[model samples]
Target: MAKDRFHPSSRGLSHHGMLPLFSHHPVVSEFHWDHSVWGSSWLFLIVSVLGYVISVQIVKMLLSFRRRPVPLGPIPALYNFGLLVASVVMFAGCLQSTMAEIAETRWLWQRSKTPFEWIICFPMGTRPAGRVFFWSYIFYLSKFYEFTGTFILLFQKQNLSSGHVIRNAMVVIMCFLWLQFAQSLQIFVLLSSTGLYITMYVYLSLCRMGYAPHFENALRYCQIAQYVSLLLASIVLIGLHYYKEGCSGMGAWLFGAFLDLSSLPFILVVNKQKKQRHVFNNTQKGSITSKTE
Candidate 1:
């Protein structure tokens, strides 16, 4: 009954696209979320990079002489909690859109019906846009807010790792590219990333509360897992692109390719560093044990 109620031809909501709950905004009609000039790809790239550079420099200078870490009483925890809540919302919204589109079909590895149809790709026009695209915009904006972490790290007197900067810059640029090209794979990206973030932030919040802090290693593994998933998914999409005539934003494939290539090495290096640290610690412990004996 619930399924039938939402059948695209339902009486009350049939006229408008998408579920009645999300029809109010007319995301497909009212707003051109991916407009040019004001929403151009170049603009997003330039602004995002400039913003990141300026923010990082300012924060670095502010913390230059401060030896002691700035005590951020509850801000980090609260901020992460807020981000966790938003990510959960994005995941749920994207899931609903995917379900609505596919109906009873398999949600994952689902086959395409038409020459241009695929689980990820939507039609050319935005009319009756689904919940997935709507949430993609939300996710794009959320990237800007993520830069706050740079400020937090600086204040905490932590080194700003290259991986962190590259990841943030890539996401910002990629999100902009998606908006420009109307990339379909973003739904998957959004869901997977947001899900990981929820797990990560929850663990972080717990650690902040003086809970199981040793699991930080697990979080690092999870972060690497995310990049691996991203790399694999990009490869899959490259294959899927050939299956159809083509999809909107297919040009963004180049961006996706570069991002995947760039991020993977960084993640692998981090993983390697962690392994080396662990081995060094064990060796030191053994040497001390022998000396004591």
Candidate 2:
């Protein structure tokens, strides 16, 4: 037998002999597409986008009403109410999801299993696990909402200075980018700690400068202090997390701490400063009238 011209296993060197472009390979098929998973992720993405848009628009409209000399009616109320409800719902969902991820990660870590392994293998790429991915997406959407709010404040000629604008913009952009790409818990915590500090500083500055109403100033100050304390606590917790659980765990902790500290001041301050300012003006008018008499 002529030494087999080619090993039996070696196919002839021909382009036509190459594997089919659309091989009916079972392994490839199974890995390529999973309808249920894809469908759910897609649906989540769609709802997220829609909710984000609605929230932004509502905020803009409400801010416009505040700035208008002749206030806009009924429509603004509807927008404001809708935006509030939507925001609360979205925030709740994000918190619930984040809590679930934390629990899962903790379980894996405690069991001496690789939690990051599941996260890494998720979505068949370096993409985070579903929980991480969803939360990260929500974080990005929240940043967009923040940016939109900032823009409205800028347009309304609100008390935000250039420094405030630059700082807040940087924080929001960094937050969005980090959540989208880094996905580490340590970085998340650090960013959040810094962001909350900056926010509190800016808000307090605005109150002190008389941008906010007088009665509200004290309350706003109190809120700023509270957030500052919270920021400090978060920073410490994040540091501990980094030491104990590596970067990813730290990141999740920081992200949460930042969010937790975000609205605390806003809620506490409300229009308290405005009320004080009104009282002061009344008192001043009375003094002037008494002098005139």
Candidate 3:
């Protein structure tokens, strides 16, 4: 048997002596996704996204007349640090919940004919709420919070997140469906991005604070590795979905996989070009120093 019935473990953050994000509370337990819930409807999602996109473009157009970037004192640094902390909490909560889910289901894996299949495949009728999904809901809400990052960038010279409205909307949609259909592997993807978000934003915060060790190359490599790793996982999920019976939310998962496939090439090419530019800049500096010597 490659499947087992689903039931979540009863545990909380108090069990780990950490933050209260893991507690058994009404907010998480009473939580349920539905069309009736706020931001759950297609119209709401479209309007929210379009509102952000239009608002941001309007601000940019208005800001273009200004000669210089606005200086918001320490706001950007504070913002990065704040997200750094939130990323830690999110990463911890999601990871803790994910491990709990997997561990609770370990017995099924042990008896399954396809052991690995169970990791990415949940049996039918699994409830879409619990500790993990609680944290997942927090993550879903955080998408809206992150939209502010682009607006924050509006004060800057060349930050590029302003162009990511569609991308952000897709993420919000994917995460919504993840909760809506109780998709398998969503935790895995969430963990990957949250982990990488911490890493990238840690570096960003440090750079903002005048830190010495800024390994741009290493960071770029890490970013690329995450995309590649998730892409591989997506491929594996696709294979398991068709061959190993089925996984919940395969339709939604396919969209996510296609999104990854489409984006990976662009990132690879962009990183390559960035690396070349970095190398060229360093070489030019070295030649200038040599001539001075």
Each model's TM-score? 0.76, 0.45, 0.82
Q: Write the per-residue lDDT of candidate 2 for residues 208-246, one digit (tens) a residue.
A: 456864443554565466567656655544444344443
User: Which residue pairs collide, candidate 3?
Assistant: none
Off by over 4 Å in 2: 1-79, 102-105, 111-127, 146-160, 181-222, 249-283, 291-293
TM-score of model 1 relative to the true fold?
0.76
Model 1 misplacement above 4 A:
1-31, 34-45, 103-117, 123-130, 213-232, 275-293
lDDT of 1 by residue, 47-165 (tens): 76787977788778878888999999888877888898888877877676565545432332244343124445543332223455567767877887888877888888986786787
lDDT of 3 by residue, 5-54 (tens): 33433443334544345434556544666766667777877788788888
Cα error, candidate 2, residue 160 (Å): 4.2
Sort by lDDT, top down from the best: 3, 1, 2
Worst window of 10 by summed lDDT in candidate 1: 1-10
